[model samples]
Target chain A: MHFNMKLGLTLFAIYLLFYCGFVFINTFSPQTMEQTPIEGVNVAILYGFALIVSAFALALIYGVFCRPEEEVNSTSDPVATTKGDV
Target chain B: MIYDVSPTAIVVFLLFVGFTLGLSFWLGRKAKSSEGYFAAHGQIPWFVNGVAFAGDYLSAASFLGICGMIAFYGYDGFLYSVGFLAGWIVALFVVAEPMKKLGKYTFADALDAKFNSKGIKLAAGISTLAVSIFYLIPQMVGAGVLIQPLLGFPHWVGVLMVGAVVITIVVTAGMVSTTYVQFLKGGLLVVFSAILTILILNRGLETKSNFKELGPVAWDALETAFADKEIEILPNDGIWKDKLDSDQRDYVVSRNPNDPPGKITVWKQVKDANNLVRLLECQLLETRAGKRYINGLPEGTGEGQAQLEPVGSLSKLPDDKTETGPLGAFGFIKTIQNSEVKLWRDDKKFPSLKNGDKATVYYPKLVPGSQVLRPGEHPKFAGIRRDGIFDKLNFLSLMLALFCGTASLPHILIRYYTVKDAASARKSTIVGIASIGFFYVLTLFLGLGAMTSGAMDVSSSNMAAPLLAKSISPLLFAIISAIAFTTVLGTVSGLILASSGAVTHDLAVSFLGLELDDQAQVRLAKIASVVVGVIAIALGILFKGLNVGYLVGWAFSVAASANLPALVMLLFWKKTTKQGIIAAVIVGMVSSLAWILLSQDTFKSVYGIADAQGVVPFSQPGIVTIPLGFLTLVVVSLMTGKSKS
Candidate 1:
């Protein structure tokens, strides 16, 4: 698979967004709000959104950093030649 | 409830269902290839697939359940819509691209892509089926609810019909037909709803006065009939009034008792000369010219914000359920629920309405069935306030499901596979979110419109929005109602597709060590679809009268608990072994299942058990099961890693 720096940048930005969410959750209190919402929507919604965003970021991060780095040397496809019927 | 369904409703409903299945069957004949059965050969255009996501995702719960809730509870129902749409951000940013890149056939394929372990396939497959079955029950039940009213048929017939149709669609063209069905229904739903919204803006809101005197004509008729007789009455209590007389012009309108005609209810008062006391009754009547219908009912008030001026899509919003004002995503809802806002209840009911300063509301009387189903007289977590920690835990758990389940749904994951590339998948998700977001905004209008329209059936809250439309024009009601029917059609079809994939691809081919070729796999899938469809039908009936969307809440919690942790671990935790995968899936699935069955909701709702027998305090298992699933996965992975290479 080709590596795309654009994807990496997008993921990093989302990580920052999640960071903001975590920070905001600590900073603000539901009691500070005009109405105390039930076990419903809160700033934590953004947190929920952020958690998934970071999950994607972390997933992309793993793909980028954890995979065994290989040379861009093999243009040939092993599965194509073997034809093991996947 | 079926009485509310008009003749136009049945014809429109049947035509739409017929068209859907016909397309599926025609597509089925050409689906001889394996590619046709799975991912529709991954050739669906991204734009159509994008809308198809709406069709697949917006289940009966979205259309009927939320709309009904909003009609009854004001803005609370729209909260569900916003939450459902917000979850799409997770799908767009995190799931869409990666999910497409990794998986083929089933969600199990995505989770097991890196490892290719038989254990992952088996466990993932089981979880997929569990979630799919859980999700399927609500859709089937929604079908029954719609059908019971629309066709004058019982709820089970509707469930049975939907199950049969969906199974045929899945058995025939598999995802090929399912994709197109969702695409069609999704497109139809958004378009019809938009048209209805435009009509709403044009019609505007008209205030119906709650105070009017219909006593003279009623008394005249009474005096002519019983002039010489004296009737016994409660002294200084309730006044004796003549029985209601029908408005000659629209007597037909008052028959069904389903569609209450347009009535401007003005308060009526009677003075008893004998006692020197005055009695007031909240009597509303349909006026022919300037006269009132005494015995006959009033017309169903028109739906839409009759009094409010149109605030364009992005203007200073009314205190609506949608993104009204500047509170951001949930700013409006948070302000209303937690803050002190103008909440009105009728004096007759709350007796609190006797306070002359408060705004008086004429809530429709609570009927027998309604009393049973209404969300327990207080919040599901009232126990929390009253030192009931168990109930609080239950409420916390349900929220957990809503929080986690959005990203883990199998039908949702499979949509990514149908798209060609990661970029396309991401783009499609963005488009889907925009569409879903726009529609959720409409739901607020649709719901709140029904509330003040005085067109709501307090009995079946789910029917409020549709009955609101029927108040406007039958033609518009017909088309929109058909679209609502197709909403069930699309989601159920998608679910059946997911279940079929789990059984055929993951369980039979991948896990069972079967060497069958593609044709046999497709055949087995088709057969499995029938069985799954039948099961969905049975579940739908058994769980009827429930808020379909709320019922799906359980499914969401279970999916998040059982699948999300396992999927997350497989990718990030390198030490995760096959045994760990199996154990985690088993523990997560069984624990959540066990907890849900023992939960108060199941005991009270499903088994018809009284409150005393309710084992677990709260109904929702999310708060407990979700964390448990994650912990089990982590701990098992750590323990098992010591020996495995």
Candidate 2:
């Protein structure tokens, strides 16, 4: 229900959707994956590398938006709440 | 073909082992209490823990296995890299913070935080030990593989050595030593891999056409010999000399025979007018009396018997030149994309008399750069090219397990406890993702480089990265191998720690309600480490010669099936009862383990039975067992919901 959790889950969904599509297309249409999507690069290599890069990009985005607010945080307490939930 | 033990390798390996042991001893003094021994007293810096995270996760599978697969099978091997990195996303978003909040020492601590039930402790503890032990096998097996070429030791010796060293590391300092070892090795692995990739690009591609000058008689004779009776083939220049009993010949003969042979085989190398050796060739010398003959094409099993001289060349260049000299990273991929690569394909097998009992010959197949860069080249992924429904499901199942498995691995999960807090855990996961992602990208180039480096050993694909480094320089080879050996040590230490924590913290203290002092607990964990280390050594020696990455896959499947469903449901679904978690963990672990044991791959590979005799229809169990776990949890929770309330 929190904004950060929503953002995290949505981004994860988007990434998984693209990743699963790439995998399915490669499985069903093997010839299509073999075709060069860009000059000197086929669909499989292009999409596979893209998935790896996208993970870091998404992680950076999550880290930026999900920063813990200092006012609600306590440094002394070992189990301080971050943004929401417990 | 014989891998002679190099003095440089011995010195570097000794230095690495000495440094690791010395660090363990130094860290041991600080790890006196239970918290310090098990969780580093929650004192590790986020960055160091992050790098240590990479160290613990990379294992031998990512280094030796992925590179070897890519070297042999082209782009298909990089698929594992993609799957492995994607799993980190799951860890970063879903598991990192909650695990740090809930668990104290082991993965089971997190799972049983809400409900302090004996059943939860028993089930989750067993699952942790199972997954950790399964993960340990590949790391130990990889250690043996590395030792064979680096130390010229037998595989069992390598397994035993790794077991003793890892036990010493774990028992001495526990998490403190494990964290620092992982951090050190993790940094070295990334740096050296980058250097190796740079060297690969700088060397570019050159035609090593040593086999091209073989006279037409040799070719025709080989073909005729394959089609008809075994016959002697000679060079037209009449400069042939018997190279039998040589190291090259001896290496080829050392492999185990697939079947008995009825003939004697002789091999000779052709020399030029100047006495320079040009080509090595095999010939059937004679047949044994009253023996049945099985004849076809020469098998590729024998070393140097049926191999074409390492023959990789650039069929096309970006600038249409003979070679692209010292290209940039993008330029390297682009040139490889445009160029034709002579990838080796093992074609047929035939009985041999002179070489090993069978000779399996690999022919050089010139693949267009586009095809080589694409997936579906590996036999495990051949179903991707086919339109069969089962094949498609199998691929999807494997991907699902990999994506979910990262957060579920017991060894990876317990690292969160070593950090200070949830925020540190999250930050460390991010750092881990970045480092691991960068290393994986380099694997693409490293693998493709080895494929064309012409340094590939036709027999052991596991030696691809080290052999590629060897082709660049012997010193680099020694350093890379020593780093690889430490890579095994770091990962194996982490797994042993996780297994020991499960035994001492979750099972003994939580489940059995054992009251103990910190010293007593640390002592129990050390004993557990030794027991688990011995088990790992035995399994590693038993399962010799398997691809470490593939073995890691089975571990991933089991972890995803057994751990993920229970953890996810318990966190998100409030109605989840202790009974539900216990039932789910036990069912998931047992069913997946049984399914794997009954699968076709296991039947053929592990049991030495016909694959078709397997009870399970498919090899991977995640597609079936993962959902079964969640369903069992939901059903059991609902049935027990009223009683708990």
Candidate 3:
């Protein structure tokens, strides 16, 4: 539970940072409408920032929602850990 | 020194092929079970799998196409690089973990995992095959493109060689060998490309003597809205005779609708006995005729080597002449940005080539130090400048493909499965992003370097980067060209692997409900690989001279449309009914495909007509098709699945 919460918070923070960076640069870029010819590298960098944040955001969601590891005490039911698990 | 297509390069390729094939054999021995063969028991480490993602994703299109595009077309080609990389963000965020958790083996598995519906499987299987075949054409075409210069062989020979080698790789090993080979090639591609970038930086920038240059030769090509004319200009460099002569050179030129009308002046020449540059001027004339078909422009020069001020020292020459050097990567942009270079556009053509009787100027005179790249020099991006809202929408629609296609590619999706679990999937995706991102940055340099490297093949843009290398040193040229040829090898293997998996795992096994033994499944996969390999070879030959990147765009749109909706809904939407999945997959796949078949690309490329009349309103189908797919699934499932209660 703790790890999941921490992961979520970390992801949210990263997402915010990236979103802000994208917006800030986009707002300030004098000719964002001019397209990739003049500032091709910058356009790539901005989009990349957005993607990074989202990738991590999805990662955190997965981490938080995923079933945590179960204790082997449940293995008392021998059939549970048997070879036919598939 | 024009390096021999050295025995060393050939030996290197054969050795690489042999080693990889041997590895496949060993791995095949261990791949006795279905799970082992299809997914490697999901045991590959995140790091290895990540590089393999690069291996799978980079394909010949990424390496050869984008680099070549950037080499010749300037920033327009980099748009593809940007589009491809941008697509990955969608994959990393939306698709990776969900895809890993939902289903096993093929894309159809997830679509049918819930209701065990044959309809979903059948639709998805067909979609996979269609998309895979579309993707394969470009790789095969790339194989042919690289073969000509690399081995002094013809295009068809290259295509055949690639087919044979890739089949052996896939048949012997299946995904096991495919993954490792990708990992290996992926690493080498990045490393060598980085090395190439460093070399470019070291060479700095320079000009070439006017004396040593080659005429800008035009191949017998089909042009849209074209005319040919020539004019004379003063010799900018000392190489040309002071007066024009009709006897020496025969310059062939053509004008397209996107080009200016009258004949601008230019010279055709090789720079410093290496770089081939065309110095062009803006044409200003009205349906006028000119002399100099042979003189072309005897008093003037063709778009020849615009004085590359001579890099370092002129080879075999005394210290009497000018001493300059090659520019760093992106140096051409700087040369144009500064007053250091006065580059010309194509001068052999007219000033006002008409598109539907309207004046169209493809290359506008941007005096050196202008603040823009080639604005409408390329026909594909003409949408960027077309007046009215529809043009803007066209540009936006194309962007949609670049954005959505990455996240949805089946080959890229399967890489997430190669790693053990979802965490590894995420990690691997991150690494892939980093590696892919870095390479894209290098493309900007490699491309502009080729564009102004005074080494461009006007007849075939595919030849841009290799020809650029040839301009530098034949030895460096040989190594770079050979490496690029191997690039096709790495990418094609991955696409074949993905398609073969779809055949054995999705279509034959799941959809048909056919049971096969483990060994039998492996055999089926190998056979399927060979069959697909043969198809790719045939199509590659059929589609020569077409841009491989444009070919990949169709693949991206199809993959995005067909696979993405089904995969996403299955993972996230609990009520995504199996029948709904079936409908979504079929509709998404078919609609996007139908849209593409009726697209301008099909008109121009597949059917040798430039008529946009029969074409659909849009260039890329992903924007509409992807959303429509989701809607079809949601609406159908909501109406159908709920009523079952």
- Every candidate's DockQ is 0.11, 0.36, 0.15
Stretches off by above 4 angstroms in model 3 are: A1-86, B1-8, B209-336, B339-377, B643-645
Give the candidates in order of TM-score, highest first.
2, 3, 1
Candidate 3 docks at the CAPRI level of incorrect
* Model 2 agreement with the true structure over B238-290: per-residue lDDT tens digits: 11124333323211111113423422233233434554332323222122243
What is the descending DockQ order?
2, 3, 1
Q: What does candidate 3's lDDT look like per residue over B1-645, in tens digits?
A: 122366655666566667766777777675556666677667688988888888788877887787776554445666666667766666765666556666677777656656777777788878878888998888888888877756768989999998998888777766677788888888877887787777666665544423222234332121211234322233222222222233233221332333333433333322223333343322222221432221122212335211111111112211222323554444434443343232333342322223222121222222322322433335666655555555455555566666677777767776766666666777787778777777777776676666556565433567666666666666666666666766777778777877888888888887787899877888898788899999989999998777777778878888888878878787667888877787888888899989888877688777877555555776678778888889998888887986533
Q: Judged by TM-score, which candidate is best?
A: 2
Per-residue lDDT of B369-453 in model 1, one digit per residue for the tens?
1221122223452343344556545544554466567778998888887765665666567557656766777776576455544
Q: What's the C-alpha lDDT at position B370 in model 3?
A: 30
lDDT of each: 0.61, 0.78, 0.62
Provide the lDDT at A61 for model 2.
88
lDDT score at residue B352, model 2, on the 0-100 scale: 41
lDDT of 2: 0.78
Each prediction's TM-score against the native?
0.72, 0.86, 0.75
